[model samples]
Target chain A: MAVIDIRIDLKKGVADPEGNNTKKTLESLGFKGVTDVKAVKVFEISLDMPAGEAKKCGEDMCVKLLANPVIHNFSVTVR
Target chain B: MKPEEIRVCVLRIEGTNCEDEMADAFRMAGAQAEKVHLKQLTGETFPEMKRNLEDYDILALPGGFAAGDYVRAGAIFAARIKSALGRDVKKFVEDGKPVLGVCNGFQVLVELGLLPALDGTMSPVPTAALYTNDSGRFECRPTVVRNDNGGRCIFTSSVERGKLMMIPSAHAEGRLMSRDLDFIRKLEENDQVVFRYVRDDGGKAEYPWNPNGSESDIAGICNPAGNVMGMMPHPERVVTRFTHPDWTRNCPGGEGDGLQIFRSVVDRLG
Candidate 1:
């Protein structure tokens, strides 16, 4: 199994408006259970390499293309 | 002093990598290299480093994702420098000492208002900018840099004329921007522009080698004092020949791409 994961920040300019809209809609629907929620996504990937080297290769993946780094942060673990 | 006795102290923090590599590079070049953490640069640690900085000839800012790019890359750390190590750095540079910043290190220097040139002297405010790439992407590639402006500076001495160093650059805000043509002209005229991205044939930073589309094809810049240098590329990562990724096909396995950078500093200190 090959698993490659990437995480990206939803900039405040773009993320907050949607989050606020959802809160309003949920409140109208009487689903007030969710509050102060921030949405973030994580991707998990498994590669062909052995576990010992997967973390090392994962870092290489980040260095190459996975993370933009300017606005996002990432962490990787091989299982 | 013997070359082996020469010391290099590398500043470090949580997200900074390449501290080990920096130590290794100096060690490989016959210098005593040590990684000193960021906390040690604080006022509380000032008493210890005041005398220590004089003992170690080279002060290097190794590359990494310092503070995980929180609240802007290098912004917080730059503030720490201003509040913590500001006076020491001021004295360090004013005394004509050598300091280097790579990748994130470059970011920190710019944040500290060190890279910007104003009125032919150091800017009292930030004049240099390293923003996101115009293409909206992080670039990773081998860049060929020309040392057109790196004249007698400690890091550029060993790089021969028309020499091309292949180094990896992994950063989003590597684009360089400034408005002082007088300063730019002075640098170009004085051979102080230091390193610029170029094609593999050493054709100036354009297109592929300068993947980020940095302004004027610039890959690196040194301060007017020539004691402070900052660049976006990762020279520490490419210090070995096999690390070139195509040893059998093209790499000739010579001095490794970044040895000259370290060697030049050692030569200067000695």
Candidate 2:
């Protein structure tokens, strides 16, 4: 069995309100050097297949459901 | 078809809280409205509970945090619909049957690639998205949306062009955005824009008036065929004058502004 990890994030130039709010909170806490904070989602899945096949399957999941291509960018890796 | 004969399927799923009012709105509009679960339509339930999408004259998706709005608002529900009944929905829209999406419902329509289908009857992938509000707050207040479709949208046919209706908006992510730079211009050219947020005096909307800071103050839009319409307002919650926030404060006692939206579609079906 192989495990696959998928990471999704807002595309470049897309607004990330939650991330911005967190950055503001950090600044208020005296972390002044926080230039930016971008948030992301990671999904870990176990597949009863080879690593190569699992990687392909993970990409399909991202395209089909996990990530919305309109405003999201994603990456898949075998673990 | 007679008004009562028009069967409206108010589609809902777990976490969808506005189906009852949506069904009631259709009923008040003289249509036979049914609150149907998505599983029921997909035949995932018992034999007696099975309902088909083609069985109804209209499909209405109401507001609420479907699937708790995880990942993105309406993402799970839209994916489920697309995987389970995408073909049927496509056919339903292609047949000229009306489809209405309000608030979270609008998000689902966009995620399901049913709205802003500029290239075809239904885009293979979503071309647009409803992003987080510019204010970064969940805005819940009475909003005014001006009809701008010029008779292209079936849902707003009863409303005069440039008429503003007071509908309440309540959501955190209702800002419509698209990667296409000419999105607004294309919608205008195709007459797909159905409503635009405006000030009470009919001037350009700003801040709370525009609510979500959508481009061009767009509150709603329709497909090229104008059979599918999606908006980020709760028209169902304001079917009667008594429900209006300022009804007791000199507001006229009559049908609520939102009623005309339902009536427009129901009357057209009749």
Q: Best candidate, TM-score-wise?
A: 2
TM-score of 1: 0.72
Off by over 4 Å in 1: A1-79, B43-51, B117-122, B181-183
* Chain A TM-score from candidate 2: 0.95
lDDT of each: 0.70, 0.92
lDDT of 1 by residue, A5-49 (tens): 645444343223335656777888898677755445465767886
TM-score of each: 0.72, 0.98
Q: Worst ten-residue run, lDDT, model 1 chain B? A: B116-125
lDDT of 2: 0.92
Tens-digit lDDT track of model 1 for B1-270: 677888778888888887898788888777898898767655356676533455567788888888887655776666677666777776777787778889888888877766744334344445665666655567777777877654655678767866777778888777775545465676676555777888887665566678767767877877776778888887777667866645557767555687778877777777
**Candidate 1 lDDT score at position B15:** 89
Sequence-dependent TM-score of model 2: 0.98
